[model samples]
Target: MLKRLALSAALLAAVAGFARAEDVTDKLKTSAAEVLARPAADYVESRVEIKRGDATIVGTLTLPKGAEKPPVVLLLHGFTGSRDELPIEGTKEGVFSRTAHILAARGLASLRIDFTGSGESSGKWEDMTPQGEIVDALAAFDWLKTQTNIDPAKIHVLGWSLGGLVAAHVAAERPVVTATLWAPASNALYNFSHFLGSEAVEKAIASADPDAVIEIKLPWGATTKLKARFFQSLVTVDPVAAISHYSGPLLVIVGTKDTVVTPQPFAGESFLAYHDGPEGLMVLPTDHAFDAFTGPQTVDLMAAASLAFIEGK
Candidate 1:
């Protein structure tokens, strides 16, 4: 039954054209491929298990070419992203994966994993929660600590979109990570409301009832009970509050033209209020995904700033 619902959701996402998150990932992949035709240092790509009590979260770990302890950075994808879904740029890597490769090339080990129920992990997305994802991250951190070539004190967390919220929560809970957020949502309530409302409005701006937005039913009819719970739980979460409690190195990046997660109107003050140190926030002259691949320049900036912050440079 769960598998059926998941499949139906995928079909609906495809038909409804509601999956804007990955709308441009394919383009980014094509662009990245052209940028990554050359060879860099050797790296290992594998799956690691993170145990959260009864459930095991499967994750992808990418290791740099080295035989000694290396600074480790954990990369997290946005909502609805998979471990392999992130592009490694056959020629030009996408932002998330590009950062991972850059870290590996600079002698840092990186790991980007799937959420508990998404990607290749063995769970149902309907049963997952942001808090559950946080536990998965902790499990990953513990696993990384056991690696022979990973330095525990030099660990960092980099999250994009929804992953940024989870990253902030994990950093708050652990308090030992150097954290970076790319186009992260701060106030969960406002964020979700704006997301649903904006998408609905974009589709209904010409409708007779302008206020009547977000009128879509669920994949299996009305909103599933589980989805209701998910939204309810998410509505109460506050990533900005979580980050405010974290006292480690932090960074935030946002595109100036981002309509999906624009920080200016929705979360600008929250971003400013929470980052309490020598943090970095770069506003790129692009859209939500940084569709403008002017030489992978935006991602390159994020990588450089993150490395500097993690190494206290």
Candidate 2:
């Protein structure tokens, strides 16, 4: 009889523990959903198209309501990522989109563009290169300069992943007041070597034809062709060195669990390169795509941190 009673008590405790754990999980999900469900009532979103050389770049500009000559943040997405980072369509809850809305809510304007080959932009994926992205970003910045509603002196640039490197390169040449790099690819050579084996990269580099294409099988089982010039371009440009030239305030945001752009050499080195600028580093407890791998709360945290940095708080 006593053994039966003890077994019943143990089972009850286990069930209660599971129930408690479930309750905690439910709360977290609810909180994260709430953050993503916020409305963008205080901002006006406009679809924009800018001509960059032969390609027509498409994007969105979010301008805050009742703010005259407000500062604008130019957002650049990562490699293979569009102006919207999330895979879901017609949702403004993605990292870049959400950040833009959040910034608008805070009375700041923001512009997010699709690079030539990605999003709604026009170009072949195989033709996209880091150098090309820099050119596209500069074109967007130049276009922003012509906008009468924007404060030219307070223009800022924010880049994520590969886009982070492009943003740094643009800031180096352009007159950006501030720059925020999230999970930036500090070394393109290192990234290429990791994605495409060193042997493949070496062969591409040694090839006589600059237009030679190499077939690369990604981790997600998709095979894509890239030009030999892509690898060559990676070797020529150093993102950290380029970023060092920008005298504006810099904010580096990296995820602690980011294996895509390893925190050690990439994030640490990129953070170290901004020696001349007033720089700040934020290490979040998440992965490379903070919200994608973790949850919406990670994005909420990121948005909060970015807003604080932009507002100089």
Q: What CA RMSD would you report for each candidate? A: 11.3, 12.9
Best by lDDT: 2
- Could you give candidate 2's per-residue lDDT for residues 55-100 as a string of tens digits? 8999999999888999999999998789977742334377888888
Identify the runs in model 1 with alpha carbons over 4 angstroms from their true place: 1-40, 84-94, 198-226, 265-269, 292-295
Candidate 2's C-alpha runs over 4 A off are 1-41, 88-92
lDDT of 1 at 298: 57
Tens digits of per-residue lDDT for model 1, 1-313: 3543453355344334321111222333344343443345777767677777777777767788763778888877776666544453334555666777777766678888888888777787766667767777777777777777677767788888888888888788774568877788665544554555434323433444423322443322554223444554565577887887787767666767876664442343355455565554455566656563345665665566566556655
